[model samples]
Target: RMELLEAFKTYFQQGVANPPGNYTSYIIKAENISRLQKLAELLTKNHIKFAFGGNQNARGFNYDRQKEESFSVGRNDLIVNLHQPAAVLADVLLEPKTLVSDTNTYDITAWALPYVYGLNAYASKENLKGLYPSLDLSMDQDAKTNATQLPLAWAFSWGSTENAKLLIALQQANIKVRQANAPFTIDKNDYPAGTLLVMRAENERLDKELAKTISKIATSQDGIFKTISTGFVDKGKDFGSDGYPLLTSAKVAIVFGDEVSSLGFGEVRFYLEHDLNLHPTIISVQNINSIDNAQVNTLILPSGDYKDDIKEGLAAWVKRGGRLVLIEEAINGVIGKKGFDIKKRDTTTKKDDQKENFGSFANKSKSNFDDAIPGAIYKINLDATHPISYGIGNTYYGLKTDDLIYKPFVQGWNIGEINNKSLMAGVVGKAVRKSLDAGLLIGSQDLGRGQVVYLATDPLFRNFWEIGKTLFNNVIFCDY
Candidate 1:
């Protein structure tokens, strides 16, 4: 019940657009000791009508059905059942067909209420698939699946994306917005035969006339008004092979460090495999270490302890103009250290450090990590408005406890201080980096000819896990 109430608060008060009319809905579902009870109490305090029916029956109302319209319900007769079946709830809320009237509004004649609306532990597999079609374990489904995801709705949100659009509009209202590349691969020849290209007239006057002309030009175009093309190239095969000016070449250099095979190498490879035209050369520095022959623009030093000479060589590489990205602790401990202090002691027992402990990498699924990291933390300042963050939303990175940077039981990660004094922000929760402290805790530093971006936590790599791909993508693909 509290979760439902929180959902209501999230929808109504958390900056989401509201419907025209003030509609009050009484939700019924299985009640456990969740966030629902608190919500019910809050609603009661607000004088909102709420009735709870234990199990299935109460006051002559069937838990599964909406009372007939002919039967009158008093203002105080709100009934909510916690144990009704989802099918019954759906039968009460969603009408089979929508009857549209002259006003373009719907008159739902056979509506049914849905008890459960999203995927959860209590949800059946079929229902979860139905609710999240895009997440359907099949690629056969079409755009219908994509349209249902909450992310799409957020794209046109009131703030982030919308604000960017408004800024663009203000700068040059008649200017055409174009995509550097199509979201999906599409050839110019594949356009429909009847397709037409329409351009808005370049006008100095920023008025409704210009807006109307743009609309008219758009309406006169081909089958439909798809996204505009900026003529910029993307990290696609054709873009890479042709070698456009907007594109550049980069090679990833993997330096041997802790969790080398398990963490560092895999991440570097993941980028190369997914991104077209990007090449990488792996250089293991376990023995004789020198970066002189490492002809690479970007170097990734995975988390681990290394010899002092290796650290010196890396510093030299940076001084000569190479981008260095480091994770966890490496030689010399450039970041995240109380101070430069090192000590060693013999193990009390000769049992090799008490037989070591092991667990899942970051204790998260790949997909959850993918989405949660970017959306979780807050106040991620860019490196002086660089191309990586151009037209990109400021994102938060997620750090799990197992990663070397994780601090156990610390409410949030500490992004370095502003001016070396104020508190740093970070993500506060387990999945999403939702706090200012977390962002500050995982910060970036620029030095010499090289740029060092510190990802405080290891970003999980599975398709469903790496929520912060865009953040990483920007860093990797930007024109730095």
Candidate 2:
């Protein structure tokens, strides 16, 4: 799919190391759709050198045919198959060993396979080691020997799909991992069913190394991994003190369509299914009228140009006790609609009779607002007492990739707001002041028996901003 390819390009550009003269080849095997067209366009826009070939079946192209078809193809360089049944291309493609294989090369393989599969399959460390000898996959021998002793363990909630990926990645790196047989509690926080327990012997040196590997993969800018050290315990009296409620029954629906303007749809979908472990149903705008509302409790609208009919259906659903989460451009779609708006006050007129209320205002008038700061990081002050802010501290970091800013809604309860001096770049001399209506990063409003949540910028943008993940999880689990 084009969405998958776009996400791959973003990951390659931002996270992976790009060496000189190194090229990547992706083997896509599926029915050609509009997504494939988009993928071709994205590859061209990025100037990524690539070749495309496919047929009605797997036997259409043989080894000689593939080579003859593309004379530019080389055998010595690395090659990656995006999806399986790799047997379709295996005859023509070079093996990993035949193409300059090493630990670094294997490392890329480990990351790339996971990216392609997303949340579809799970690969254990032993399986990975058996497959790739170049991977220096080895678990601490003492750790396995002293497994029952008072060893240090890292506990990750099973609800997070990102955690699952991390668990797999760690395993691929030859680290020892296990799921808690029972519910466990660390400090005051409760971990639910299927919580991953990353354990190692209490060797300070090895522990630090393990931490580094996780940090490299997780990449939470605010240092989420560092904060877990204080709560480490093997068999404390407080173990399993409290149980976290499972959100398995809660169903979340994400809107997707043929809208050409849609952005962040793949990121949102990936984060929900892969990071949050919430398998969300993809609802197309064309079929919105046919779907049953009772099956879905929460609906997510990603940044896109939505049809008016789709917007009306969502609005009507929210009024009937269905929760709505609007991100970026979708925020504008629900403008002047029920339970989501800025509630702008007239600043020009003093007379009560001439007063008027508006939903949105221009951001250029504000001295603190910067127009579209790409990759800018900002601090978000969270209301810890609120359900959506549960388990999150007073403040966490959020990423902004757009220019949109709103005059904060005074009447609505402030669930999360941008902190003073929150600007990370652009116009460095200008001071970011706290205003009654300045940077309202996130807010909630009661609509009938349900709730409407609005986010000015995407918290799960590219699934890179790790600190905002808990807040997004809260949105999924919180009862509105």
Candidate 3:
């Protein structure tokens, strides 16, 4: 058990360790913003060394827009978000390659660290069920066999083309291989449908050496193969087809300006460039007039302050049949300024002018752009039939950190909606106001021959919320 636990720990550490990068960022979401702030404080008090937004007085450093801090716990370069729920980016030492493989490393690490550290804090505070670290070791169960009489043949599923290369590499290394007559299943995972199994006859010395080599390759950073002791057999269940549909590349341009905040821009860029494998050109908002619409299919504007001219130019581009994707604060910039006018829902507390309490209530009616929801999970009703909702289900969960209270759209379709039950955190009691009433979460407006896609809250927020990735992808790939 100790050995297994230690291996698991090493596995997780390697999974999070930076991969040839200056800094490694981890996104963490808690039930509420307070819990996340507390975790940041705890890390600071413990001399863990971190940086965050909002609380500059904390033990760790505060995020400075100018400085380039390398990911180092010692240097106190970790980035945390306290004003809104965001993913935390910290420096992680790159573990030696021999220690652990990098297969699905970032995805696994993102999920694991939050569960280990962030969720633990929430679990302790709210008395919620804490997540326990686990590894699926069912493969070990199939390996129990007589040591000398171990099966010589190995089977691999046709899940990936890389497995074929593995077979060739083994043969070139002098491991004898022949095709087996039958297909087999191990641990309920069916092998290739073509009865394609590679066999190496059990020669005492050769088989033992081959086993060691196979084990080393399986656990190596480059290998994706998993081995079982079972020999090849005939007439086993097929593991399904290993094919993917070819997708056309869309030219995506993201608007970046000197005045724009890097928080949302950075996260959106990271997802598009790294996760989605889409190379989007970073178009300056100042250079909006210089863009050639023919070269760009989709233009994304991250939540940030924009000049009226930039908005006017983008609005013109949308009218020329270009697809514009607006996120968070960007929604306000385009609305009313351009042909799109989405009025803010009246969330003001009613004030009786004749009453003595009017003075206090009048002060609260002022429009506050800083209004936010903060660390809440809201269910988004997706119109799957819409081009933007392609490949997505009927409903999806959106992390609503910002409250975009817009009046009913005068034109276009509401692709996504947030219902009353969608509220999960941040707002409570009377503070919830009329904003919680069924409101538009996502909508598209037709502008001449083009379209404007508006998302109320960030879907690829911090790149931690994996549920909304498809929705974001659809936005990138959808034909306007």
Estimate TM-scores for all models.
Answer: 0.37, 0.45, 0.48
The ten-residue window of minimal lDDT in model 3 covers: 121-130
| Better candidate number, 1 or 2, judged by TM-score | 2
* Predicted structure with the largest lDDT when compared to the true one: 3
RMSD in Å for all candidates: 20.2, 18.7, 17.3
Task: List runs of model 2 lying over 4 Å from the truth.
Answer: 1-248, 258-261, 276-278, 287-291, 339-372, 407-411, 425-437
Which lDDT values do the candidates have, in the order given? 0.34, 0.47, 0.49
lDDT of 1: 0.34
TM-score of 2: 0.45
Instruction: Order the numbered candidates by TM-score, best leading.
Output: 3, 2, 1
Candidate 2, position 435, lDDT: 25
Better of 2 and 3 by TM-score: 3
Candidate 1: regions farther than 4 A off = 1-247, 257-261, 274-279, 286-289, 292-294, 307-309, 335-392, 402-439, 461-464
User: What digit string (tens of lDDT, one per residue) describes model 2 on residues 303-409?
Assistant: 77663735465656777777878787777666765546554322232365343445356633342232213344455677765656544445554555554555566
Q: Which regions of candidate 3 are displaced past 4 Å? A: 1-248, 352-372, 426-429
Per residue, candidate 1 scores C-alpha lDDT tens digits across 1-480 of: 999988766654432232211122233332211123333443455443335332222122222232222122222222332222222222233221222232212221211222111000111111111111011213212322332222201011011212222323322434432222222233342221111122232232344354344443323321112322332223232322222223223456766545354555666566555432245676766532356534677777666655443545666666666666656454224533322122211113346524553646665444344223221212233333333433322333233332122221133212321211111122222322222222233444445666666554444333222223434544444444
